[model samples]
Target: MTYCVGMLLDKGLVLMSDTRTNSGVDNISVFRKMHTWSIAGERVITILTAGNLATTQAVISQLEERNKAPSDRRPSIMEAPTMFQVATQVGRLLRDVIEGRQDGGMQGEGPRFTASMIVAGQIRDMEPRLFLIYPEGNFIEASYDTPFFQIGETKYGRPILLRGYDRRMTFEDAVKLLMVSFDSTLAANLSVGLPFDLQVLERDRFDPLHSRRILASDPYFHQISSGWSEALRQAFHSLPSYSFAEDSTPSDGAR
Candidate 1:
């Protein structure tokens, strides 16, 4: 249904999410899958969503409403004291919305309320942190052994990250690796399409360093896609050739 990745590096954080929603072969549309809340020079938080659109929207809407109310409610993400508390609030809200909607009181066959999110950011006095929240309200943080998180149609694009990802890599290299990873996923999954959203938050800056939307017609994305495909082809062709000159198997080889 989507492709969202949150990569934690020594430098900061890189988050990207596709903007495609597909219900059937003939039903397709674009909806932004990334949302950010930031108080420049104070704190920043980004959320990437995947799964049932209604459920995700409702959860976000509820949070936004709470933030806009009479100022007596809990602080919004922009005012949160810690990234962990922000994530905790969001996870609880998501679970409550899904469970409330699934009680089957409104009508028969209640609308599917399944969704997950990747949340990342840094508080003014804390280090950058990244988290992946599951549909059930539980979450896990990025660790040294696995410094990245992915949700939705992730299998296709995951291999590149597995081979190239490292906490020591620079921000520029991390962006390139993610572009390839997203490119691979785009090529293989119909449910995930472009108009990608990316955000980079440098460590301890308490602000976003870079944020942009990449459209389907963007030249850089096209170049990355084409270049990666060509590189793969060349690598395949360069592999050592193993041929049987006499059409007879070697004694050490399987018969």
Candidate 2:
């Protein structure tokens, strides 16, 4: 399992993904789930993946190979005219990879090789866009109604995003928001362990404004985790206390 978020903000895209994979408690491992490609000043693309690691890796490897030696028959994301086209290409590739695996005898009652991805980025002269690509090659875009996408181990961290996301928030605030979300997830799920990868892409830049790995030793993330816990406790206590007396007047039902 993993956790990855691609947020659409007025400033551009903010993306993060955890680096943990485990078949069992004793067989845990770390693997990067974030992948990016760019053409300097022309375009920049980022993908956050979740699900079957083998399927995800195969999809990413094919994209990398295309980028390295793009041909007319096998076009690269860098050549895609728009962010939408780029997303379409990625979705198709991801679907093809998973289907190929299923055809190779990894089907029936065994573990299904499926995966999902969040594709976010911008092309020259176009606004940044965000997409959630599923194993079936279908996808949806982030819009005013849904300005973000989350894949993998999402339930634990979704509430934080629901309450805190803002379209006009600063990049600094966005990262802080994601940290709290990831921290909540990490506390609850063993399969989503960190050393998270983060990237902030400013509008029209065609390159990442900030990129780094948040390791276990990262002081800021530690602070965010502990501080958020304390804050939640304080907020819970501060809310109006539940009063049994207020609920003791159920005369209609009792009668």
Candidate 3:
């Protein structure tokens, strides 16, 4: 399992994905799940994938190949005219890759072949957009009512996002929120480990404004994790204490 989140904010887009993949306790490995493509001042695309490694890798490889050699193939993500088209192309490719594998030799209902992705980017002169693409090739875009997308190991960290996300929040606040979310998830799940890939794109920049990897021992991440834990403790203690009515007298027969 993996954890990836993409947020569509008024400022631009924020994305983060963990780099851990595991088949068992002893078979864990680190594999980056974030991929990006940018044409300097023209456009920028970032994909955060989760699920079957082979399926996601195949989808990414196909996209790269198409972009490198567009003559005999359909439009690649880099060539898509709009963010919507980019999501469409990626969804189609992901579905095709999974279905092709199932048809080739794997069982039809094998869960290991399933994968999902969060597609986000900005096209020249167009607003930034975010999409969560399912394994079936269908996707949903982010809106004010739902301005973020999460894939894999999502349960543990969703509460923080639900209560804290703001469409107008700054990129700095957004990244902090994401770090808290990822930290919460990491604390509860062994499948999701550290060394997260993070990217931030400012509106109209047509390129990433910030990008970096957060390692397990990174000072900032450690500070955020510890600070969040202390804050939560303080908040919990500050809440109104529960009260119960005191018994006025002993039971009639107990005295």
Candidate 4:
């Protein structure tokens, strides 16, 4: 399991993903789930993946190979004229890999050979875009009403994003918001351990504005995690308390 979030903000795009994968309690490993491709001043694409590791890896490998040797059947991501086309290509590739596995005796009824991705980037003069590509080769784009997309171990962290996301928030605030979401997820799930890869793509830059790996001991993430816990505790206490007087036995006299 993993957690990956991509936010489409007025200022730009923010993407973050954990690097944890585990098959069982005794077999745990860390593998980066974030991948990026860019042509400076022309285009930049970021992909965050979750689900069946083999399936995702195969899809990425094929995409990378196609980029190096473009064929008529498989167009390179770099050749896509728009971000939408790039997403279409990725979705097709992902579906192809999963379906191929299903054809080769892998069960299709469950998560076996299934994977999903969050795709975000910009093309030259086009507006930045974000998408969530499902295992079925279908996808949905981020919009004003839903300015962000999260994949993998999503439930534990969704509430924070629901209450905090704003389309007009600055890039800094957007990254902080995502960090809170990731922190909430990490506290609840061992399969979603850190460190995390983060990327910021400023609008129309056609390249990453900032990118880095956040380690377990990262000071800012630590502050965010502890601060959120304290804030939640304070908020819980500040809320109106329930009154028990009506339900009480009226002091054994007024009843």
Candidate 1 backbone collisions, by pair: none
Model 3 lDDT tens row, 49-158 = 99999999999999999989979658888888899999999999999998888888787566779999999999988889999999999999999899999999999999
Off by over 4 Å in 1: 106-111, 243-255
lDDT of 1 by residue, 151-235 (tens): 9998999989999998989888988899999999988888888899988989988678889999989898999999999999887
After superposition, candidate 2 runs with Cα above 4 Å error: 109-111, 246-255
Q: What ordering of candidates by TM-score runs from best to worst?
A: 3, 2, 4, 1
Task: Give the poorly placed runs of model 4, Cα more than 4 Å off.
Answer: 71-73, 108-110, 247-255
Clashing pairs in 4: none
Mind giving the per-residue lDDT tens digits that candidate 2 earns over 1-255? 999999999989999999999887888898999998877888899999999888899999999888888654797887889889988999999988888877877787234688999999999888999999988999999996999999999999999899999999999999999999999999998899989999999999988999999999999999998899899998876666544686664333211
Per-model C-alpha lDDT, please?
A: 0.86, 0.91, 0.92, 0.90
**Backbone clash count, each prediction separately:** 0, 0, 0, 0
lDDT of 1 at 109: 46
Clashing pairs in 2: none
- Distance from true location, Cα of 228 in model 1, Å: 0.6
| All candidates: TM-score | 0.90, 0.94, 0.95, 0.93
TM-score winner between candidates 1 and 2: 2
